[model samples]
Target chain A: MVAVATPPRGAKRKAKAPTAFGGYWRRNQLKLAPWLFLAPGAFFFALYVVAPILQSFQISLYEWDGLGTREYVGLRNYEELWWDDAFWTALRNNVVWLVLYLLAIPGGLFIALFLNQTVRGIRIYKSLFFFPFVISQVVVGLVFAWFYDPTFGLFNEILGVFGLGPVAVLGDPDYVTYGIIAAGLWPQTAYCMILYLTGLNAVDPEQIEAGRLDGAKGWRMLWYVVLPQLRPATFIAFVVTIIGALRSFDLVSVMTAGGPFGESRVLAYYMFEVALSEYGFRMGYGAAIAVVLFAIMMIYIAFFLTKMYRDEKGV
Target chain B: MPSITKTRLLAFAAATMLAGAAMPAIAQDEPLTGELRIFLDTSNPAPRAAMEGMIARFQEMHPDLDIETTIIDREAYKTQLRNFLSANAPDVATWHAGNRMAPYVEAGLLEDVSDLWDEEVSRDLASTKGSMTIDGKQWGVPYTYYQWGVYYREDLFEQYGIAEPATWDEFKAACQTLLDNDVKCVSIGTKFLWTAAGWFDYVNLRTNGYEFHMDLTAGRVPWTDERVRQTFANWRELIDMGAYIDNHTSYSWQEALPFMVQGDAAMYLMGNFVVAPLREAGLTDDQIGFFQFPSIDADLPMAEEAPTDTFHIPAQAQNKEAARAFLRYVVDAENQSIINAELGQLPVNSQATIEDDEFLNAGFEMLSSAQGLSQFFDRDAPAEMAKAGMEGFQEFMVRPDNLDAILERLERVRQRVY
Candidate 1:
């Protein structure tokens, strides 16, 4: 619209200097305004996010010990990662986390439905369900570590009532990853429950009533009417849960530190272990792991964005 | 390297001239006039106080020198060292001995301090010189070291009619007796993994002797070597007997103390540091006792594990003269005695007097008479190899059947690491 109203460039320059510049500004302000506002944020975004990402890629191609001179050994870090057993172990654990972490969505919806009713002391119950989410992930990790302790845990006591002997859940490599994930799921489920609870508050009662009249109740009502209305909430929950699963560092760190022979390592924790931990000084190898993790997140986000774009177009 | 050596030579010549000019106060002929920054990781209550006190005393001697000190949490300091050493270097920094200092030396982050190790200092601190030396030059000065051996429940051993084992067969026999009576022979926590390496170090040092053990840690010997397997085979006997407490991997070294304190386990193979905690937990001096790790081979001379803590000056430091004085003051026998008395540890200087604590005396005696002293596994080996080796040790303790696989995995890591 502004371009059509603007005079040709040479004709504008021939006018009075002050008026000509003012005229140019007036003509292009609409197009320039949004970009002008976005410049600061975009500059910082490039500096902090994009620049580091590119640097990580460059660093992954060299061999650096964080203290010594960087020797360029192109693709060697990545090549070593191919045969690295610890890398594979971490990758496998990440997949397990991703798959199991999604269970929180349904787990949350069920809890939300159970607590959605209006009853005396219902707020108390809702607050209690939300308590785990409010606490720090570090606290959650500590609580769960004690809960799964081999000698004196409540879990073992509960098992002892059934005459089963104690089991060292954290010490056993076969159960270490699962043990940490279950600890992770405690807070994640609470977080999702809060999301669903808010989504439930916004749910339209009229549509629910209409569905009931059409013989849709229980699971049917939820699937066809209630869930469709909660799509936005569900979408947010899915995105956060996936990210939480992928970025599962604190729980594994606080609970296990990728112990029992690195059986419980997620890629995030493994990268930290390889790059910065007391024994870890391999900066290039750590960068390679970071690059791989970044690639994974990029592919997932790209696919998600494309679907979201198409969905918006359809809408 | 040449520039550093030339600087050292110049400083030494200047010191000699100053000493000749003023014979009365030779050490202080050149009055120090600069800022000296020291970063310490003695964040624990006792050690922190000890270090602060030591620095304060040093500050008193040179009132004109501006001394700044920073104390970081012990674990956090391990990772922060590289950042500070390269970016914002202090004049003096605390670090470990042996291969733990290798990376810094190799990267030229640490200054060469061999000139400070004069004839008297060398003779007094001879035991730790091997640990502090990388290549032919010394990079740091050891202030303190402590022995690693079996700290056991004396009452429990006496109650079970068991004597302190002096030989391998007697050790097994005692473990068997303890096991028969439903007591775990040893209480070890391998959760952090390095505790497992402690066991590995003692066993390897005992079975194959010090040279082979050092070779193995240096990655000169393959993990799959027969001597290495022999060490593991000796360790397996204890493992097969269920000598160590069950589920050891679930607890940290501190967490394993309850077994010995409560008389559930007979022994704990740990450092001299364990004695302090055991006493604090209400175990009497009579109840807790120290013993050398029993001899595994009659023919091999005994070696001991004694990890030393040392201080180094950064190569990039601005105040080398003041820093050298601080290090020299640090290793003075009297300073070592004063600090180690408060530290409940052994002084690195032979002339220093030890506290009259029973366990400390025992450790001092054992370490003094030892043919060789090894810095514990994590300190001796490269960090990557130490990590992989310790993880394998923990795995082996839990599942002895996995020994072959663990050894092969360690071999792969060693090949890559070296």
Candidate 2:
């Protein structure tokens, strides 16, 4: 078979070594192309995300004051966190936030159902409803802060008309966290509504017709057919809402600054306060708090990844 | 071959850039020509204008020196200061006097400026130097400070037939009278958590004196101390009389200004800086009056809250010579006065003449008449203790029954922090 390696000798050809880099690359380009494209993103993710997460873990073991020398104190920072009242309060608030934040899903669905009908100027109404999401959480926080103001706020004015109360939502420790979480829910619900609306648009008409034929008209039709088809949207809504609740910082920070006695603090805000606030640079302690938050988040992230993995495998 | 040459050229460029780096000791003796970055809080319009004037003047005086500045809001500055001070620091930066500068000094983040305190600075403003001193070494230069006291509506007080009360009981009676007359006696905003501390500072200073106030803030005394509890007890009287505006915790000190002006609340305890804001809010000079916080104990000497704004050179700063020169030039009596005139605040320099305004005059008179000056509670206490103390103060204001729990928590923080 030595007729110029079974090729037409009319071509200008030279024998190339199989071990050459270019030869190997050319041979394996299809298999390596995806990985090559992914390299840049992986590098940046490692640098900004993975590296900092590890660095925080390492720093959590130290007693550093940012500007001064760092002393390795092992798990002392974490140990201190165990007895820290603020830590417990922040953890409790975060749990409350997570539990209450799920309300956005149902809230969004309720709103979507009401707003889904075709009516005159309904697009304008939908836009107005979606307005909170378009604006930033910072602005929303400020708005809600004014709304919840005890004396001069619109909320108090409303109460005054009813001869009810001038309740200080942020001032009372009992109501501060709830007040802030409600502010957060305003935008989050709008986000969930959008997701569900998109999901509702893609719902199969044939299934709806079939359900309608089987005496499923209202709630029965939605649960039997419509809801099953909207699983993807519900999943997305749940994941984002959970994450939004866990990292609920901007609204709490803008609204309360974890004040009226740190009653409204989440772990994120508490971490920032301990490390970088006017309170001395306890970088180590702050890092420890960050590590705890990361650990808590990791559980959910792992759950999410496994769910995605299994779902993909099923498909 | 070209790539090899490029690498060599790159190395050569870096070497030339560091040409002045070999003899670092002798570099300080060279003429000051590099950049002098100043990080300061100039979010307020008046102070920002004043700083721009100062920066322009400095640049005019020294054409050879280059200056850069990073401006930030005051509230954000508290956190941003620590972030930048440790790395890529500016040559000179703004900071508070007293215990606010303690942590930075302890960490060796701020440079020692004792050499700048010559005979002239020593003879006239030694007290300021003492406040910025840690372990007998000056760490910063105080350029401005202002008095804090009760700013009341003169017309409202007159209507209520209330005089400026000088004793504790008289103050309580006045508060009761104001309440009975349907006027809120005191308006405070604890949203930022520092306004309540101003009240705490005044009460503690009046009841226990400056020495005890300083000792308490410096963590020499426990929050469980009888005298400390006594300070809170005196504060409780105002609370008992329903003195403060209802729901004060939801407003900032600025947001609380309306209650004072609209006659809903009669008096406001604040620094002299707010006079400009107050005027902007439509309260004229004749309508407003300043009075010292009433004395709680006859034996205790009067001490006023006067939180000073100071400047310091960061220890890690690159341009030391220019920074030292800038601090020296900025704190000259004339410069301090010029900045203060624009800022509507009193200059730290005793020789600097403050502007002729009703509140300014009253503040100067009040400060001069005082036996001692405190840098306010938050400034005098370390950040951790200050935060806990202020939060406790806010709690006590909101729920006076939580006094025991708040004090116990503060004591734990004091023990741990110190």
**Candidate 1 iRMSD, 1 decimal:** 1.1
Question: Chain A in model 1: its TM-score?
Answer: 0.93
Worst 10 residues of 1 chain A by lDDT: A12-21
Q: Which regions of candidate 1 deviate over 4 angstroms?
A: A1-29, A120-124, B1-37, B59-69, B318-322
What RMSD value applies to candidate 1?
6.6
In the range A1-315, model 1's lDDT, one tens digit per residue, is: 998988987765556555766878878999999999999999999999999999999999988898778999999999999988899999999999999999999999889989999999999999999999899999999998899898899888888999995988888899988888888888899999999999999999998888888999788889999999888889888999999999999999988889888889999999999999989989899999999999888887998899899989999
Sorted into a CAPRI-style docking class, model 1 comes out as: medium
lDDT of 1 at A151: 86
A1-103 per-residue lDDT for model 2 (tens digits): 5865776563333344445776788789999999999999999999999999999999999998787789999998988899888899999999999999999
State the weakest 10-residue window (summed lDDT) of model 2 chain A.
A10-19
RMSD of each: 6.6, 5.5
